[model samples]
Target chain A: MATVAAKAGEAGIVGAAERLGVPLLTYAAADLAQVAVPNPSAAPLAAVGTPSVAEAAALLGAPGGELVVQKRKSAMATVAVARRRPRGRLALVGLGPGARDLMTPRAVAELRRASVVVGLDQYVDQVRDLLAPGTRVLESGLGAEEERARSAVAQARAGHAVALIGSGDAGVYAMASPALAEAGDDIDVVGVPGVTAALAAAALLGAPLGHDHVSISLSDLHTPWDVIERRVRAAAESDLVVTFYNPRSRGRDWQLPKALSILAGHRAPATPVGVVHAASRPDERAEVTTLAALDVTTVDMVTVVTVGNTASREIAGRMVTPRGYRWQS
Target chain B: MATVAAKAGEAGIVGAAERLGVPLLTYAAADLAQVAVPNPSAAPLAAVGTPSVAEAAALLGAPGGELVVQKRKSAMATVAVARRRPRGRLALVGLGPGARDLMTPRAVAELRRASVVVGLDQYVDQVRDLLAPGTRVLESGLGAEEERARSAVAQARAGHAVALIGSGDAGVYAMASPALAEAGDDIDVVGVPGVTAALAAAALLGAPLGHDHVSISLSDLHTPWDVIERRVRAAAESDLVVTFYNPRSRGRDWQLPKALSILAGHRAPATPVGVVHAASRPDERAEVTTLAALDVTTVDMVTVVTVGNTASREIAGRMVTPRGYRWQS
Candidate 1:
């Protein structure tokens, strides 16, 4: 049971909390003034130092919950109830590979449902049109993932519906992992999946992933190079189709060639490789080449390099991996 | 240049084709009668044994292409131009984990744009509402993937816009491979990537795929059990997060247990395992258990079993694989 500080000692409210076996919570006028209520008036503020006593107190008592009932005025007191949701909602949404049509409908809906939307600046700009009016957007530049994760979690903790957006499927080398690491069971987390770069690139370059495949990110910003290399070697030894994300950047150019060399050690020099840049976007470009023939210099941060397995082939102009080992024509 | 059999040898048309250095192709009335044209007239049927010869010949001439112009008649001759697309377009669309909201806007748009749609009956039913009014749907039951692939390619080869849909990402253990194998350079193919089962299940079960991951389907229908086991072992030995698709079916219950045993060899018994059944659907159910605690009997064809890597942990009842190798509180 909750009430204003002036009514905390009142007999009627105190008796009700005691009878219900619930703790009585009281809120200060200044604190109550911060909460946005559906209805507000001057009478309670002038007489009791708060515009809303019962409603504000109810909301203050239920952290990360919602106000279910409005104030009911009686002759001497007003009563309200706030329903505590099991937890606040935090939707980690994936915007897909930089195209409006490629984004899932659920991702767009979650953006509209959220009271707070957090993402990197460029990614936020991609979906700004989908957000409803009054949606609060907290956007930052690159390398601020940790801060964005914490901010999204905090907003959800405060009972706001929050959406933390990332490009591609949020779980695959994106925001979901970082955000989930910072999040606890205090909030409900819903992951909305999207088209990752590998799938998008594969679509453009035919079906290089028709069989078993592994995706390894080459960025050593968080993970070490040794770990990335070991995974690449395993993928090569096992003859699994490999999709390399974050393959190269201006600062990290050698990794892609070294990784391709490891794949070449296991695969024939002529094994097909598909390189896709900015898939589904207007400037999207895809090429099918051989492992040995690929010029790593043409690659960059946005490029996805897919090396086909032993059973993979180039039919006509598109790279294709047979679904079965028999590999019939 | 195209014309009906009656006008194939016309002096003016022959001279024009010769002057333009283009070969003139003529279609028989029987073949022209088979093609459905936008404009059908009784005058042509009565006079030349086919309705709308100009439109039909143009369509037949540009196999898998549309008639760009309606029939224009002169006193003695009728002419029409059919623009042949470099190739027919075949869009391998992923419907995304059985939820309409999870379906990408591009997937929906592809469904609307397609003149013909081919898929497994259940997947087709999921997107029937999104198809344009006159769209042709070629739906079949399970195990008819080969036929569906052939039909979609044949439609595109004839210059029709086609969409071949699967439940998850079509390139991942779906129709893309078979369709691509049958498809030559004669048609344009677009892959509209969808949220694959692995990504969809990962989202529902926190972030089990936060780090490096590999997806291997356990169904030996197309792949041999030995190949599947080898891939599973590689995934386990490398500590790569693993997502098992087609984990179990009534007739194939043994594979899931065997695959789990392979992972258990390297992973701790308490390693987190997320089992998601029919993710994002009304009957969707997800649970995070340990490697030893997971009940394979609870899994089915529709289920996705994701086993976290060595770096993965169950935090606050959600499975989370840290993005980095170093552990932190």
Candidate 2:
């Protein structure tokens, strides 16, 4: 190690130190593979409650199967050991925020092993280069979700490794549900999350969500406009930190304005609003303004908007959405 | 373009076609940077009713100068071009989910250039070796924020290019705030966002956050405990999607249980809940369960708990937190 420093510069030192840390860390993708439980039938008959805790104990040494489900006052419970190969097989993956560079090693690993890839247009586009020559790609729009679900299920049932790709972390507001809803007893699926846009954009704007905030999407596809609008109003009325996803569409530009009107009712017009578009992508854009000047028209499918809660403070030219951490402490 | 098939395969043609679509793409970084407002003293004046939009334009594109304040319907009256070398600089950066392979080219570029990097002990520790020889490392602990803030300010004012790094995206409950508060007018701070934990975990979970759901932090630190409780209850009551950050602290394990109690009000005991810990890292762990089986005590600082909204559905063994984009068309 000392000789390495003599031969290399600061970058070399960084490389050496990093290598040291890697060895100190215990890593086993296989363990995760084991935890990739697909069908409950094949899963060990572990009780769901305290008895399950004992089962969880037996599998403590395993990888992804350590289910830490915390009931109110109960002790932590671990699920069963993750099997190496479940009867069913499926994968949910995130493509990172707009850029291929931000995709995680895990996501890449899953993609490499996947025989069938299912995802939205943008997500598939980002990782288009990685798909194997004969890899089956399922191009999907927002509609026909059930079809995609059935397709993934059929592929998984056939024992093909499948992956459902989302642009952000798949668990947040994306495919985790539809995939599960569309699945049957015969399939196994594992999730691989990526960077979400709100977080990506918040990083660009100096931590608008550093503390407590509400993240809501202005898009009203499945949700009633009333419900979406009410949620926006509720977030604003509460003075909670807020983030807006799918804030506007060419057909629904007015939604943001009406939502803003609701926000203006409770939030000071000057509430800081951070807008980041194409986050993590080469052409990413970010801007911080107040509720009064939020331009709904400029934001589209690719944009994410974060509005400071009442507690958010603008300090030294940057915005900090206080999580109320200091107060709690 | 024909050879593109050789390079991009099926995805290449799809991407090329998508790029050419006649959609009204909104403004991204390019649009904002186009109008140079040199010397903050001179810049375009924005009209009222859209401060968030216009004020953001001024703050981002205006020359480094003293910000002028203004107030409008959705804008801030006090917006102006800033023209000055920042006395203290803040860079809100996201580290993407772990592996250097996942690091965005832009994110990596900024890290190599940073002179002072401040972040939580875990995050700082993760990237310690990535810094240059002279780069000062400041450990920012979640528990001891004041001390962290002071150090961040002190270092930046010392004229060091600082990288405030965070795991996932820096903006999502990461490093954006401390730098904002500690620095002053002289600091020249900027933000570099990375992948957010939620997104990374979601990717791992296969698009759980695929739709419009509410994101909330279980940590009561920066927020009133009552408020945290309220939001959790409200999110559940509204049958809205919910995510819990800082879900379980060694000292505050009870928060999760309390949250579950409220969430159970809206969701079934079988309502799906996904838990992700140390996502994208070699130590990454993930699983799926329900509100009934959720045990909050098992999670820690590294974990994110996502509770599905009513529309949240599971299919093909994958969970989908539908953002309802399909609801739009």
lDDT string, candidate 2, A1-329, tens digits: 22111223446444754887721112233232233233322222332212222223324333233434321222432223223233657887767676665666667878888889988776787787888778899888766666776787778877789988777666555665566666675666676656677766776677687765666777666767877776776676556677788788778788777877887888788888888888877778888788888777778888988888777766654667754656423
- Of candidate 2 chain B, the 10-residue stretch with the lowest lDDT total is B1-10
Cα-based lDDT at residue A255, candidate 1: 94
- Residue B169 of candidate 2: its Cα lDDT? 63
Which lDDT tens digits does candidate 2 get at residues B175-247? 4565576667677766665666666666555556666566677766676688777676667655666777788
Error of 1 at B327 (Å): 7.2
Badly placed stretches (over 4 Å) of model 2 are A1-89, A120-123, A138-146, A171-176, A315-317, A325-329, B1-90, B96-109, B140-142, B184-188, B200-207, B250-253, B275-287, B296-302, B312-329
**Chain A TM value for model 1:** 0.78
- DockQ of each candidate's interface versus the true one? 0.55, 0.30
